[model samples]
Target: MELRHLRCFLAVAEELHFARAAERLHVDQSPLSRTIKELEEELGTLLFARTTRSTRLTRAGRLFLERVPYVFTALDQARASVQDAAAGYHSQLRIALSDGISPERLSRLMALCRQDEPDVAIRFFEVPLAQQLKGLHEDLYDLGFAQSADVDDGILAVPAWSEPLRVAVPARHPLLAHKTIPLEEVLRYPLVMGDPEYCEGYCRQVDRILRSVDQVPLVTEQVKSLNLMMALVAAGYALGLAGASQIQTCRESGIVARPLDRKAVLTTWLLRPDAEAPESLERFVERVASLDAERRLTT
Candidate 1:
């Protein structure tokens, strides 16, 4: 019935142990039990089944659990909306960023937005690909940038920018003899790649590119952060693969980037809810689009 009740129920549902759940909620076990009991009585359903040794959710509880998270999400969105309104802000744009986007391009786009519409405030969130998709659907984010274009039916993913994929080799490495390295040659060395879990979009693109190689990739390390990967590469432990923008922006010590022989590119996409966009957002997106078009033509 109340937010606290839902919180208690969720905690109990997840832990399936009264004492553990109480500890997690930072409450006494007696009151925690009372809260869950009250919730069950109010709903006229048994939410949990308990025995001396174990506790599990009832059928009703399982169904309720499926829908309870959305309630909290809605409450959070409402609170943020009220706070923004109280601050006397006319409009706000929330953008979620997943992976490493080109820093130079992001700077230029933000500058364009400030020049065109200084009144609208913009906020950025560094999130995972899954979180970005969830937030967009829940109205928590207005736009998102990710490496992949794959999205659900109601979400629109438009290609926003593309950077040529390059190999970051340690200084004085033998491969540095060639200006552009072949993918097959790069795979022959110990490679430090992005982790598939954190960098899902980027890893997916890398996987596609590696499909051409007959030899299994000699992956020495998988890292979630580019800085860590660069460090590993600089140590001569492995070769790093990344977009030209990342290598340029990082300026990592003891690491030099070389273009790949093939035209392998990492594409960043603009993800938005498939609904009518606000005029301010439309203007910002259009500016990004024009910039991307120009960059493509010149390159």
Candidate 2:
């Protein structure tokens, strides 16, 4: 089939509505349907199952949706390659780090890349986990650090590094008396928490731990970043769960961090889109993968 047919199919696949897809493509209803029919005929499979008022992608459509975007990504990368080659510029890397990465870790990462790959220019975006997922799909960011979740097929994620999960307690808080606080024990105090819609995987794991003992966290505060969450904890508002690295420098800043008595922690990952990443992007991925192998200054 022609590329136009594929585009039409993709439009319908995305909107999941015949009329909307037709409007998006700047075409009328009948032509869009015909194009989808032609594509189905060529592929020998029905992509969508339709009713009078609604449409949904079939299993085949779901699989195809994961792949078709890669085609466009490859095309975009190819054009960028040619343009960069002609311009005499080597390559550029763009990265997105979640708020959980320690300030020291970020400083070291920047230093390491600049020292080792001086010819490459690096840019960083302080993105939340939810935005990172969409940016990865949009090719807006080359790589992202987040917990693994429902990632699409065209994205490849590697376990880069993990920090011990710690409980943030205020200095005068009664829980500070214990050298190691139990997860169940923390239920006595209100909790300041992250927004699950943005940080889905971490929130899910935290919920599983508390739910096992039939406990519901008294969420006194809902926050998206560790900085604000820690601030609230320091202000004697609520306790919080965050990476140990985040609180390494906070003990003197009036916030106390302690490990949970049972096994409780958060894991971070490095994700790369599958289509085509620049050389600089690939190098950053490799460096991040090997970061733990080196001496990471963790508290």
Candidate 3:
């Protein structure tokens, strides 16, 4: 019914313990309990089930939890928009990044945007592929960059950039004996791969490449980020599979990036809603295309 109600509900839902939630909110347990009761009375549904020893969310509570964060996200964005307007920005762009987009490409694109449209405020949200797609459909993001072109009906995906997928090998590793490592040979050793949950598109692309070979890969670790994967590889824990640009940007020592003999390429896609595009988004899309063209020319 109010901001306080949502805040108290979220705290209780997250903590699942009234006393702990009260402590987290810096309030007494009695008031927190009364607030939850009042919210339940207003909603006409039970939110949490509590026993003498434990507390947990009911089905209604779990469902309500899903929509609660959007309220806060909208509020935060509203506050940011006011701040941006006060700073003399005419408009703001909400861009999301997923699947560990190439840092070099993003840096170049950002530099171009700042140069071309200094009045536009650019905000980047690093999220999973699913969240990016959902935000696009929900009008939470103007556009997003991801490694996969796959999407549902409401979103359109366009290929923005492509780069070779390379193997990250530790220095002095046996795989380094070959200039271009074969897929079967790379699979022979343990690998540090991107987690499907955080890097869904990247994992899908890498998985498709690995499927070309009949042998099963020995994945020793599933990392959430390329840096962690490179770290594991540099420590001789396992080899890593990542885009050539991602590997090139790694500052970790003792990591040698070798191309795959099969020449698999990872493509980054620009995902947007299928509806008509705004002028700013149109310009941004064109900028992305120009940058990709320049990259292809130099490479």
Candidate 4:
């Protein structure tokens, strides 16, 4: 009839004795006897066979006991799941990232987060700036990381960190002639760029800087990630643009990096909806902003 009735029935079914079931339930034997009688009367069937020496479950009682326990287990599991979500503890934290990110830097930030919140799950999506903007507003992501946040004004974007825009050059490029090349001189040559659609946030700034100097850079090639950008540059396609941290990620072969005119700063931003964020989101933003040092890769 009620949850308590189901519980009483389950306990009595398990023990097969009124006295023992009463003790297990922390109730008096008289109450236990009354509860079983009430359960049987409600169900219109005898639940147990009783004798002076022992008590045992009937066919119906055994079946019901199995079903009732399963129902309770399902209810308990659902309750726990809700509590976990309300506490801002998800099995996974869904993240949307802009392309051209330095894998090394991203890995380091993740290691720090995991070191503290071991149970937090990390699910990454390589999303374009347009997708990040739309999905974040619709409550589809817990966080969004971008080379810059120039696309959306509805989202609260905070500068999390910055890395120098390194120009990855081939071994014999004239640009490599300078230990730390200047931006103006580098722009004179064609530039290989990441897809502007995905990296609109970063490329917009680069475009602005180039326009100020009245330079229309020749497009040599297009790439997605910093690793690929560096690879293309190493093959001598054209000069490449990337953050200093990215250069560190791509220092595998003949690629070389130097400051591009006073080390043009490439900023990383922590993005969330402009509306009030959950405590979990706030915690992530805070941890990212308080990093003690720069990015590093983990095996």
Number of the top TM-score candidate: 3
Give the clashing residue pairs of candidate 4, or none: none
Best by lDDT: 3
lDDT of 2 by residue, 1-299 (tens): 78798799899998999999999999999999999998899899999999997899999999888677656655656666667667665776767776455666667788889799776655566656666776788877788777655477788878777778889888888898899998889988899987776666677667776776767779987787777888888888889887777777554368988888987767677877887766677778778766767756543
The clash tally of candidate 3 reads 0
Sliding window of 10 residues with minimal summed lDDT for model 3: 66-75
Clashes of 1: 0
Per-residue lDDT for 245-285 in model 4, tens only? 77776655888787766636778787888887666667777
Model 4 residue 211 lDDT score? 71
Query: In model 2, what are the clashing residue pairs, if there are any?
Result: none
Off by over 4 Å in 2: 1-89, 250-252, 295-299
TM-score of 4: 0.65
Q: Candidates 2 and 4: which is better by TM-score? A: 2
True-structure lDDT of candidate 4? 0.75
TM-score of each: 0.77, 0.66, 0.90, 0.65
The number of clashing residue pairs in each candidate reads: 0, 0, 0, 0
Q: Looking at candidate 4, what is the lDDT of residue 176?
A: 75
* Ten-residue region with minimum lDDT total, candidate 4: 290-299
Reference-based lDDT, each prediction: 0.88, 0.78, 0.92, 0.75
lDDT (tens digit, per residue) of candidate 3 on 103-143: 99899999999999999999988888987887788888899
Model 1 lDDT-worst window of ten: 72-81
